[model samples]
Target: MPKLTFNIFPKEAHHGDESVWSNLIGGPSSFSLESRIFHSISICLMGISCFYIPYNLYAGLYVASFSAFIFGIFFFHQYYNSRFNARKHNNTVFGLIGLLIFGVNYFANSGIHGSTDLIWPAYLLLVFAITPYRQHLKWLTGYLVFFIIVHGLEFYYPELVKYPFLEGEGQFVDRISTFPIPLVVVYITIKFIRQSYDREKKAAEERAIAVEISKQQILIQKQQLEDSNSEKNKLMSIMSHDLRTPLINIQSYLELLNASEVDDEERPVLERALLTSTNNAVEMLSSLLHWSKSQLEGPSVHLAEINLLRSLQVTLDMETAHAAKKEIIVSYQIPADIIVKADLDMLQLVVRNLIANAVKFTPKGGLIHVIGEVLAQECKITVTDNGSGIPVDKQDKIFSIKAEPAIG
Candidate 1:
């Protein structure tokens, strides 16, 4: 089934509430909604007056005819002003004109005994709708005071008033004709109020839902952090207990071998044991430290303009000296002015690690090349060496922490 949506007023009027009464005080900054209401009411009054002017003329009521015609002109003028020259249509002045027109009709038509009394309250309601919220109490008081005074004057001097309709169908027609003004006024006022209430209620509900969702996300993140810390602590305990003893044993044997002379065969075994243990300890510690830092402090990247060539040159110089011991050739092709956006220390660390690995894997007298180039928006750095790379089967795991460390 197709969904059904009910809207009392057009979507434009509902959304443009601020503009509905442009001259009203104490409303939202935009007057689109209020302006819409002003235009709509003006059209309604114009239509009503059009009918009444012809009816009054046919009935030979020149006074009523002239008044209805004037009302028609006033409504047309206001409609145009609100539609185009909105700034010129002062809200309070327009409201007073409506009140004055209705008040005059009250006395001129039948004084306190006419249909004007029936339309007076609704006209005031219309005034309240178009006026600013802050001015509502004042308008209400003024209307009520004026109403009482009119009734008081009529009560005191009944001879001073005139009755427009005779007792019969003419009076009935006048009452029936004036009925729509109040009816339309009340309907529009109630619908506008209801629409505003619904919009505010819906907005509040959405805000509450958003706040709850944020709270849930925060709770989930907090739980994940707790689990990560628990796992890291357990891993730390295992590494400290299991690895430390063997590492210490290797170090003690190296110290002992250094302190005394040993047979060639025993010395090689001790050196090999110390070397294996040292490599394993270094790799394990590196993985553990990286994991712990990430879990506890999170990753932080500080970006700055870095001289890529200078950073790579430094790494190459350090690695080249180490390579020189094995009679390896280390060459670099780096432009001096090549710059990139990166964290200086992080970039240097990464380059040093890559070059050091290349030096370790390359055979004696092999060439190692460190090159950098600017490719579009990125700076590409390459480290190459004439060394046997990782085995095809282990290639995928080379960057993983669990990958076994290999020595040249």
Candidate 2:
């Protein structure tokens, strides 16, 4: 005996609950429209089949038509309820009712003539096969029960087999015995196709997600590398600029010391050079520390309205000794009321660098003038020198990373 499995049953247990099946069935009125149209056609066909049954030759047609009409009316009412109220209960009940109507009709119609009724079982098998797998088990059980009852009736009342359609039917029982086989084959084929489609969709979604994640990671790494490179460039610029002046002063002082006699009058001049070198080195270190702090920690601006003339006076006073030793005359022309919003430390560094550069490049007796003016929205501080001014061609490249002519 072939063991019955859930797969073999006519109507499958609703395995996935109502939520799952609702998604599969889609929204309300979608399947209902189709069901309504099918039932309406079947009702029309049943009415036509009744007319044909008047002729004995088409007697079995009436029975088929009557069965179709009964099932159609039940299905039509179910579809009507489902469409109006959006309910699954009606659909489930209608399906069960369809199975019962078809089963009973098949047995009654087949009793009169076994050969003509063989096709009824084949029709039932097709309907069960085409239905969704979740509903197949229940229908299959109904089919089995109907089959056993019909077969028993045929055996007990052999006189019911005298219809003309059975005379030339040729072994009706044997020919239709394996009707369930074709249904099983079709069900398996559909199930396989659906499973394969779902697997491919899932794989594609996973691949898309993986690709997106990779793109985000690459973007993050690129940003980190750019930030690191920027910091390195800033550090190198600070080191090169801050170290140049002190090293030059030290070299000049050492050369003078080595060339001159101990009793020479230029000994005091050499001592002044040493003092200037030490001061320049200290200023450079301080400037570098300030720049580094600004870059690393964050903006630390302490704004104040400072008198431009007073600030210039203070800077010139600080650099006066070095300027006198170099024969560079420091002068200033500014309005007393000129004020600007600035952070004192940062403005001092800016002015100091400009003054130091002027003294370094200016020849003996060259004049270094600090000028200040107030515009409508901004204050202008200018450091001008009579020594060799920056060449026109090198001015643009002064801020470049390569060596360039100095500004006086």
TM-score of each: 0.58, 0.44
Cα lDDT of all candidates, in order? 0.70, 0.58
**TM-score of candidate 1 to 2 decimals:** 0.58
Candidate 1: where is the Cα deviation over 4 Å?
Answer: 1-32, 224-242, 258-269, 279-408
Quote the lDDT for 23 in model 1. Answer: 29
Error of 2 at 272 (Å): 6.9
Q: Taking the tens digit of each residue's C-alpha lDDT, what string does model 1 give over 204-273?
A: 9999999999999999999988766765665565346334433554557678588767878798887876
Worst 10 residues of 1 by lDDT: 1-10
Candidate 1: global Cα-lDDT?
0.70
The best candidate in terms of lDDT: 1
Residue 92, candidate 1: how far off, in angstroms? Answer: 3.1
